[model samples]
Target: MIGIDMKLETLVNNGPAVIFLCRAETGWPVETVTANIVRFGYSPEDFISGGLRYADIIYPADLEIAVSKFSAYVEKDYRGKDPDCKVEYGEYKGEAGGHKRNAKGNLGKGRGGYDSFTQQYRFLNKSGNVLWVEAEIKVLEEEEGKACLFQVTVFDISRWKHTEKTMPSALDTENELKRIINSGHVIVFLWRAEPGWPVDFVSENISELGYTPEDFTSGSIFYTDIIHPDDLDNVRAEVSKNTEGGRDYFSKEYRILAKSGEVRYVDERTLIRRNEKGEITCYQGILLDITQRKKAEVAQRLNASRLEALVKLDQMAGASLKEITDFAREEAVRLTGSKLGYLAFMDAYESTLVMHSWSDSAMEECSIEDKQFIYPVKSMGLWGEAVRQRKPIITNDYPAPNLLKKGYPKNHVHLIRHLNIPVFDGKRIVAVAGVGNKEENYDESDVRQLTLLMQGMWQLIQRKQLEEALRTYSGELSRANEELRSVNMMKTEFVEEMRFPERAEYGEIMDYETLYAIDSQQQKAVNTFIHYSEKLRRLVDSLLYQSLEKAGKIDYSFEGMQLKDVLSDAFLNNVFLIGEKALEVEKEVPASLPEIRGDREKLTALFTALVDHAIKFTPQGGKLALEVKEGADNVHIVIADSGKGISKELIPYLFDRLYQVNDSVTRRYQGLESGLYICKNIVDAHKGEIWFESEEGLGNLMHVKLPK
Candidate 1:
C-alpha cells in the first residue's frame, strides 16, 4: 500500500500461508522464514536464529517418518499411492527412465528436479500445544548435482480437522452446507432468483477471485456480471432449471471474469431453496476453481511439442558444430516466434564476438566487409549489454536511441522487439544468442525453451571433441606398435644368422688353426690368426644373444633349479682359467640354497658372464669369491674379486654396447666391450638384475638377484 516497490512483499506477507526457505541437508535448518510465520504462533526470528531447526518443531513421533519421506520425495523416488499424488493415468506414456510426469504433469528428469508434494505433519508451537499443519514443498535450488534449498508453504488445518470430528450424523445436510461455505477451495453463494441474480450472501473466499462479497451485495455489481460473457447463457439456462423447479439441482463448468481482468475456470453446483409453499426463493451454489488443472493440460501439449523437437535434435548425431548451431538457431526462431535469430561466438577471454550462424526470415546476407562491424561490444548496444553485464537482455522497443547507442549498420535489418541470451560454458559466456522482431513480446518461457535447446547442442559439441581426441590417441598408439613389430622382425633375422651356419664357420677357422700348427714354417702367424678369428666369433655371439634377449626370442625353459648347483657348475667351467691365474678361490655357496623357477641354461650363462668378467680383470693370485644365499622371494648370488677394478668415470657406462673404458690400442681385453652389456640382457630375460660396485685399485663386487 505504501509503494509499488513494497507491494509484492506486503501481499505475500498478508497472504493466508507461511512461506519458508531452508537448507537441504539433514534436519533442514532454516535460512529465511517469512513474516507470516506469526500465524503459527511463532516469531520468524525464532527460526532464523539458527538455534532451532525445522525437524525440531516436528512432532517427535513423526520426525523420522517425515525426514525419510522428504528425502525420498526430493530424490524423485517417492511415488506415493494416493490417487491424487501419483502420476496421472496416461501421463507416463513415453517418458524415460529416472523421469516421469509428476502429479502436476511436468516431466521430472534428474534427482531433485521440478516436483511438488503435499505433506501433513503436527508441529509443536510456542504455546506448548500441537497444531496440525499442511505443507507444500518444492525444490527451489540445486547446486553441484544435489538439492541445496527448498521452498515450503505451510497452513494451519486444525480447525478443518476439528470440524470433521464434531459434526453430527442427523444434521449432515446442514453440516455439509456449512463446510462448503467455509471451505477455502470453493466459494458458496445465495443469489436472489431475479433478473441479475443479485447476491444475498456469499462466502468470504470470493475475494480469492479478486472480488469482495461486499461488491456483489452493494448492488453496483451482480453475480451474473462476473460470469464470462461467453459462458453467461449456459450458466443462466442451468440455474433457471433449479429456480424454476424443472430440476431440484443443476451443475455446470464455465469461465468467470475476475476483477483483475483474468479469466478463470470454475465448476458450479446449484440447488433451489424454497419455502414449504413450493415456490423458488433463492439459489444456493458453490464454485470450485479448476484453473490449475486446466493449465496443466495446456502444459502437457507444450511438453509433447518440446519432446518432438528434442528427438529431432538428438537424431543429428555426428553433425559438425556449425550444423548443430544452425539447427539450434532455426529452432530458437521457430519456438519463440521471432522473425530472425543469430548466434555469435566469443573468444576465450570473451573479448571478441564473431557471428557464427544466422536464421533470418528476410533471407538477408551480409557482405564480407559489413560482417566485420557486426555487434562489437565496444559499440554499446543491446548485444553488447549482454556481454558486458553477463546476463540476458530483452527490449520491445529495440530501435530506441538510448538502448542502441551505436546504431546498426546501413544494411542491417530493422529489429523491433529483441531478446538476447548469453550462452555459458561453466561460468564464462562463450556465446550470445539474439532473436528479434517477434509479433508478441518475448517472455521467460521463450527464453527457457531456447536455452534448453542450446544446452543440448553444447553437449553434442563436447562429445565430438572427446571422440576426435580418442581417434588421435589411437592413431599414435598404432604407429608405435608397428615400429616395435619391425624391430622384433629384424632381431629374428639376426638370431637365425647366429645359428648353425655361424658356428660352422667358427669350426672351419679352428680347422685352419690346426693346419697352421702342423706347418711349422707358418706356426708363428697361427697364434695371431687364431686370436683374431676367436675374438670376431665372440663379438658375433654376444651381439646375437643380446638381440635375442631384447626381442624376447630366447627359447629358455623354466624349472625348479638350486642356485648353488648353478654357481658350482659356472665355477667348475672356469676351473682352468682360475688354476692358470692361481687365484685364491673362496666358495661360500650354500649346499642347499632356495630353488628358483628359471631357465637352467640362462642362469648358467648369467653366472658364467659374471665369473668371466672377474677372472679377466683380476691379476694372477687375486682373491675370487662366489657366494649364494636365499631371500624372501629370490636367490641372491654375489661374485666378488680383487681385480684392477673399473674407473669411477667409466662405471656408469660399463653395461653399454661398444663402450670401452680403456683405449682399444692398449686394452687388455680380448673382445669388444659388449660382454657386460650382453651379461645384463641375459639376466634381464630371466627377470633378474645384475650390477657391480667397484673401486679403481681395490676390487669389484657384482650382485645378482633372481626371483623364485
Candidate 2:
C-alpha cells in the first residue's frame, strides 16, 4: 500500500539490513505486490517470503503480545480502547529491484535496502547480504476497491545492528583470561580430539598436571591421552557439544588428574566468544580450583556412612516406612545433639501431614491442627513457619517472640530448641524435619552446621533433576531420530513400490522425476540419518565436556567452532546463489562465519548445500537472504530466497535428505538438487533442522537451524 522502492535505494552502505512493514490484508493483489517487490529485486527473497505472510514474521516470544494487542484494538475499532494499541513492528525489507545499484549508484549489489518508512519502522533490504531486525507492529485501515481494508506497516531498524567485523584484540581478551586463571590454583589446558575437538590453548598452571604448557600443547599433552581412560569418551562427547553450541550461559563440571598424578576436582566459569559474521562462539571457559570443595563434599559423604554421636543412626538406612518413624522417635533424643526432635511427612498438596516421627523421650507431639505444629504459614512456630517458607529456621530462645502462639507446656519450656528444614523431593516439600529440646538447645553454630548437612540430603534431589533432564532431551532426540530413521527405512520400501521393468502397469515407470525421487530419497534419507546421528553424538559429547569443564577437570579450546566460515561458504555457494541471474550481491559479507569448536567441515558443507539452492532457484534480479543471529550456545543462520516457491506436494520430498528438487530437469528448477539434501544433512549433523514455507509463484524461505 505504501511505496518503498525509493527508500530502499538510499540505505545500502549504512550497514547490513533488516526490513519491516505493515501490509493490507486485502487479498491476492497484496500477495502479488509482495511477490513483485521480491521479483523486481528490491528485497532479499528470503526476507519477503518468510515474514510477508500474515503474522508469520513475529518472533515466537512476540506472538502472544502482537496477537493480544491487535485483537484488543480491532474489537474497539479504535473507538473505545487504547489508541496506543497501534501495532508497533519493523518491516521485512522489500525485494531488491531488477536493475539496482549501491547508494553511490555504482554497479553493485542489487538495488539498495530500505530507508525509514514510519516513526517506528522501516523496510530492511540486504541487497544480497545477511541482516536481521527486531521490532513491534500496528495496523491501519484505508479504502480499497470501494471497501475498507486493513493493513499492517512494518518498521525495520537493521542499521543499528552491532556487526562484528573484527575479532577483539587477541592480547586483551587472552590476557584477561590468563589473569583469571593465575589468580586461582586451577589447572587449565585445551583438549583436542583427533577426528574430534582440537584444543589449542592451556594455562601455564597446567604444570600442576605434571606437564608444562609446552608438554600440554604438544602431542605429548593430549588430554584424551591423559584423561582417566574410563572417562575419556564421556568427557570428549560433552566438550564437543558445548564447543559446538555456544557455551556462554551453560556450565561444565568434571574431574581430572593433576600433573602430580593426583585426582583433583575443579570448577570452570564460562566467558563468551564473539566472532565476525555475528556468531557467538563457544565460551572461553577458565578453570578454578575446587579441590577443597571436593574434599569437603567427600568428608560430608563419609560422615553419612556412620554417625558416632547417635548410636542408632547407622540403622536408619533402608528402614521401612514404619521403621523409619520408629527410629526417628527413639533416636530423636540424641541424633541432632538435641534431647528432642520430630519429623513430619506432608501430604501431596502440602496442605496437611500424613505421618509424624516424634521423640519418645518427649511427653507428647502437638496436634495436627494445633497452632504450634500445623497450618504452616499461619503458625508462628519455628517448625511450621520453616516448612511454610520451605527453608531452614533457627531459634535459640524458648518461646522466642512469635514462637508457638506465645505459649508452651510448663515442662516443655525446658526444651528450648531450634531448626526446621524442609525436605524436598523435586519442587514438592514432602517432609519437614525439626530439631529441638536439649540442655544446650540449638544455637547459631548448630544451625549453621545442620544447614551444611542439607547438601548431602539434597544430593538425591540433584540426581532426580539430572535424570529428568536427560530423559526429556533424550526422548525428544530419540523421537526425532526415529522419525528420520523411519524415512530412511521407507526409502528402501520405495524401491519395492516402484513398478520395475515390465512388472507393472504404470507403464515405463510413471516419470523419471518419480524414479529420481525414489533414488534420491534413499541417499537423502541415509545421508540425513548419518548427519543427524553425528550431531547427536557431538551434542552428547559437548554436554559431557561441559560437565567435565564445570567440574574443573578440563580446559577445552573454544575457537574451533568455525561457524562463520561454514555459514559464509554455505550462504554463498548454492544456498543463496542466483545462478547466472547476474543478480548483484549487496550487503556486507564478513570474511567468514565465526570459528568455534564445532565440526567445521560439516558446518561448511551445510552452508555450501544451502547457498547452492539459493542460487539455483533465484532468477536474475531475484534476491536471496541469509541472516545470522547468535546466542549463548548456538548460532542461528537463516537462508531465505526469492524463487519459484515449493509446492504443497514437495515438502515431504524436500526433507527427504538426499533427494534434490530436480526429479526431472525439464520439470523442476531445483538444480544440483542435493543442495537442500546436503543442507539438511549439515544441519542435522550440527544438531539442527531445515525447514521452509512457500507457495506457487511466491518465493521460498529456508531456515538452516544449527546449534552455535
Candidate 3:
C-alpha cells in the first residue's frame, strides 16, 4: 500500500509526463502532454498512447486502442454523460521488474524493500513489446464541485504485485480454520480400543480442532470417560450392536458431560471400520440436539389426556347422580392432582349453594355453605364471577392480587391454588364447585379436569336435588309417627297416675321432698313424650302449610308479632321438662333481635328443642341463659349454659342425627341424640345456622345466626 501511494506522488512530480483519459465512445485523447520516453521505455509508453477499443495492450495485444480512448476523452465535453465510466490501464513486465521484490525472501542486513513513486499503463510499444511508464492529469471541476474527469497518476506496481503471490504461513492457515469453526461447525473427538489404543483424534477439520500437538503426549485417551452415566448405556449398546471384529459404523443418542457437569444430549453418527490386517481403525461422529423433539412428545400426551376427559363427561350424561358427582371429582383430581375439591348446587333463589362438599381433613364434615371453607356467591368474589358467568375458572394461587387489590383478604394467600367452576342447569348457573390447591397448580390438565367436573355436575345436580327432596319428606313422616305414639302413651299414663292410691309404706319416707321426687320422675316421662309429639306435629303442620302457600293455596303471613312474644310461646311448649329438671333460666332481650317473618309453630319447635337440650345436659345447680343482639337485617339469639362443656369433636357433629356420645353413661345426659339435630333442622329451615364453641369443663355457648 505504501509503495502504491508513493508511486502516485512520483507520477505527479515527474517532469512533463504525457497524461490522457480513456473514453468508451471516442477512444482517444484529443490533446496530450509528454516528456522523454526513453527512461520509461517505448513498450509501456505505446501501451498508454491509445485508449480502449478492446482487443488488448495491457490486455496483451491491442496497444493502439488504449491510445485512441485516451485522445477521445481529452477532446469530448462529457458534460451530461453517464457518471459511471470505465478506465483501463496497463504496464509492461520488463519495465515493472525494476520495482519488484520478494516479500517472502530474506533481504540484506539493515535493508528494507524500496518504495515506488510512479506507475503507468502497461502497454505494447511501437516495437510491439510490453513496457511501463508514468502518467498524470487533472479534470475540470464544475460549479457543483463534481469532477467530470479523474486525475490519473500512474507508476510501475510490479514489485508490490509480486509479493501478492507468496504462500500464507502455517499460522495463517490455523487462524483461518479457527474463524471457520467459530462460525459454529466442526466436531472433534478422540477414541481408543481396549481403553488405550494410541488416541485416534477425529475432527471435520482436524488441525483446527483447537488442541495443541502437545495435548496428544503420553498415552491415548478413552472417549467413554466423557459419556454421562445416563447416556452411557445407550452409547455402549449402540456401539456394541453395530460392532463386529472390533469395528462398528453406527449412530446413537447420548449425553456428553462437559467439564462443568452440564450434560448435553447429542445424536452421534459414527463411522468405523477395520483394516485388512484385522486391526480396529476409526470411531468418528457428528452430534446434534433433540431436546425440543422430546418436549413436543410431552405436549402431545397432554393434549390427548385433555380430549379424553372431555369425552368421558359426555358419555356419563344422565347417569346416576351419585355416580356422576363422584366421577366428576375423581377425574378432576386425577387431571390436576388437586389435593382438595368441592362441587356445589345453588338453590332456586340463587342466593347460596344448598348442597356442597369438599376435600379437607380440617373440614370433612363442614358444608360448602360454611364460611370457613367455601367462597360465597353473593360475596362479590371469584365465586360470584364463576357462577354469574357459568364458566370454568382457575386461580393458580390464592389471595388473588387483582381480587385483593379490589379488597379481598390476605389470609387466603396461604391456601395455595384455587379453582371455581359453574354448572349450568340451563340458562342460569344452578351449581358450582371450587377445587383448590392443585398439586401442579393450574395447567392444561387442571383446565381440562375442571371442564369435565363442571359439565358432569351440571347434569346431575339438577335432577339429584329432586330425589333428595322426596327423601327429606319421607324422613319427616317417620319422625312424626314415632312422636304421635309416644304422645298417646303419655296421655294414658298420666290418667292412670291420677287414679293411684298413696300406699302405707311403698316408701316409708313419704314427705313433700320425696313426693316431689316421685312427681319429677313421672313428670319427666309425661313432659318428654308430650313435648316431642307437639314439636313433631307442628313441623308437619308447617311443612303442609308451606307447601300449600308456595302453591298459592294459603296466606302464610301473621297479623302482627313481637319478638319476645314469639319466644315466650316457644318457651311454653317445652316447659313440661323445665319443671322436671329443676333448671333455672335467665332471659335478656334488648330489642336488637327483632321479630321477622316466620311461622309460630316452627319457632316453637326450635325453641322447645333448645330448652330441652339445656335441661338434659345441665348439672343440678347449673342455669341456661337466653340472650339476643340486633344487627341491621338480621338477629343473633344466643343460648349459653354452665353445663359440662361438649368435647371439641362432638360439637362439630352435634346436629347430625343419631350422633350420640358413646360415653354417655360416664357423661350422664338424658334424651336421644336427635334433640340437637331437630333444633338444627328448625333453625336451618328459617335460613339460620346453629354455631357453637365448647371445651371440656368450660361450658358451651350456642349461637343461632338468623337472617331477619
Cα lDDT tens digits for candidate 1, 1-708: 558759667756765568888888778999988787776678888889987888888889878767766766666545544442222111234453334554655454345333467777788887878887788776666554456777778877776557566756644697676665665678988999789999988887888888887898888798989899988998887776555533446789888888976779898887766665546788888898998787677457656766777777887887777778888888888777788988876643455677777785634643334455244567655568888988778787776668455676676777788888887754556578888888656777777877877777765654454345345445544554555555555545644555365447665534565444345433323433443443445555675764676697878788888777778888888787688689999988766676788888877877777797898779978999887788888877889999878767556556654333333211212223336766776688788888788998898999988898
TM-score of 3: 0.31
Residue-level lDDT tens digits of model 3 in 1-708 = 999988654543342333443322333332332333333344334435554221243534334544444443333322222222224322222222122223422121222221111224464544565545344433322112222333344444343334333534432687775555444443544455554324455443432333332344234334565567667777677676666423245677766654444445566776564565545565655555554565466457766775786677667655766667766765565556566666765643455564454544315533334254344456656556777666676676565566422354433323567777776533445567666665434765556557665765554443343334344545655565565566566556654665435674545533567456556655555555565555455434544544564596743333334567767776686565566566788999885445576766667667766766666667876788899888777778888788888768556556543232542211211112335655665676677778778877867788886677
Rank order (by TM-score, best first) = 1, 3, 2
User: For model 2, where is the 10-residue window of minimal lDDT?
Assistant: 663-672
How far does residue 88 in candidate 3 sit from its true spot (Å)?
A: 39
Candidate 3 has an lDDT of 0.52
Model 1 residue runs over 4 Å out of place are 1-183, 189-202, 214-265, 268-285, 294-305, 318-373, 378-386, 391-420, 434-448, 461-708
Please, what are the lDDT tens digits per residue for candidate 2 over residues 551-640? 977422224555665555655554222444666443333454555455666566556656655565677787877677665666666666
- Candidate with best lDDT: 1
Clashes of 2: 105
Instruction: Please give the RMSD of candidate 1 to the true structure.
Output: 30.1
Model 3: lowest-lDDT 10 consecutive positions: 663-672
